[model samples]
Target: MSDARRPNPSNEIMRRKWVRQLRDALLLPPALLYVIIEEIFWNGATALLRQIARTWPVRALQKQLMALPAPVILPLFLVPEILSHIGGFWAAYLVTRGEWAAAMVAGIVIKGSATLMVVWIYQSCERKLLSIRWFAVVHRQALRGRDWVLEKIRPGKELALRLLRRSRAGIIRRFAAIRQVLAARLGFRRRS
Candidate 1:
């Protein structure tokens, strides 16, 4: 076999061992932390909201509000998301005060309140909020702006992807060249 095509068992084993160590030492802990955070904050909040929505009074109010016109009810749908964002910032502020436990409690409470508000608005209005004239105008303008921005950035994104691919290929080629030079040096030394 040509030297380029020959498989080096030692290199393969070393590479596998290095990858295993990297994964165990560097990758696993961060991945586990991310999953835990997602489950606790996102999934837990969703479950809480679902449970609250099942109550009788909230359900009745939702039904009543849902029967109303879209323009009249549209403003209510915006409250929860805005409040939740504000609450998140507030929780972060609390954390800076060294009140980690209180920060967590505040975050949960704020999220729960926001989720409840959202659920109530959503159950009552559905997609009717989009039908409001002023809201529709703003939504359309926002979409147009987004499209314009994307169009402008599309060339830059493609350039970045192209550069990244080229850089990766160049690095691989350089590594192969270095490996060949090292192997040649080692083989000459062994023969001598």
Candidate 2:
């Protein structure tokens, strides 16, 4: 048989090993990611609100945060992030083929990864706001300081965010309302 037609055992083994590695590299623990992402999003959001809080200087961040409910919270943690992993596998496949296809695949992977990264950051804010839990401390702490801390948190925003955590339904309703307002304000030319 021609060499091109012959199967190579070493190549097969290597591909298996690579595939395993890719699966393992999906993402790190949510809690750990939550901590790092939280700090960054909080600080950044604080700065953004400070710039735009002319209406309510003292607690603009708090208020804005509160107005945001959990349903909105769901997509922030979901879509882009989960798609990112899906994108990763697509990326791996891209590497073995056309250069443009690889680039497109890589873009998808990056977008997904970036979204997950944003989720990580938002999660940090969410943890501090809604108080996300860590698996490691499951035996000891259960969503600790979440409600208490938020109740005491500033800007009158906590009430809304607090309420979001209270009822998933409310969150969905509010998120729909907010999204509609946002779409109107932004004047969307296209829908995502």
lDDT values of the candidates? 0.68, 0.53
Worst 10 residues of 2 by lDDT: 27-36
Superposition TM-score, candidate 1 onto the true structure = 0.44
Off by over 4 Å in 2: 1-66, 98-101, 108-124, 128-192
- The clash tally of candidate 1 reads 1
Mind giving the per-residue lDDT tens digits that candidate 1 earns over 1-192?
Answer: 899899999999999999987865675454444333434555555544565566788688778888888866866767776776677777778989999998888777885577567655754565787667787787688566545445545677689888888788888898879767865764522344
For residue 114, model 2's alpha carbon misses the true position, in angstroms, by 4.4
C-alpha RMSD by candidate, in order = 26.1, 20.0
Candidate 2 root-mean-square deviation in Å = 20.0
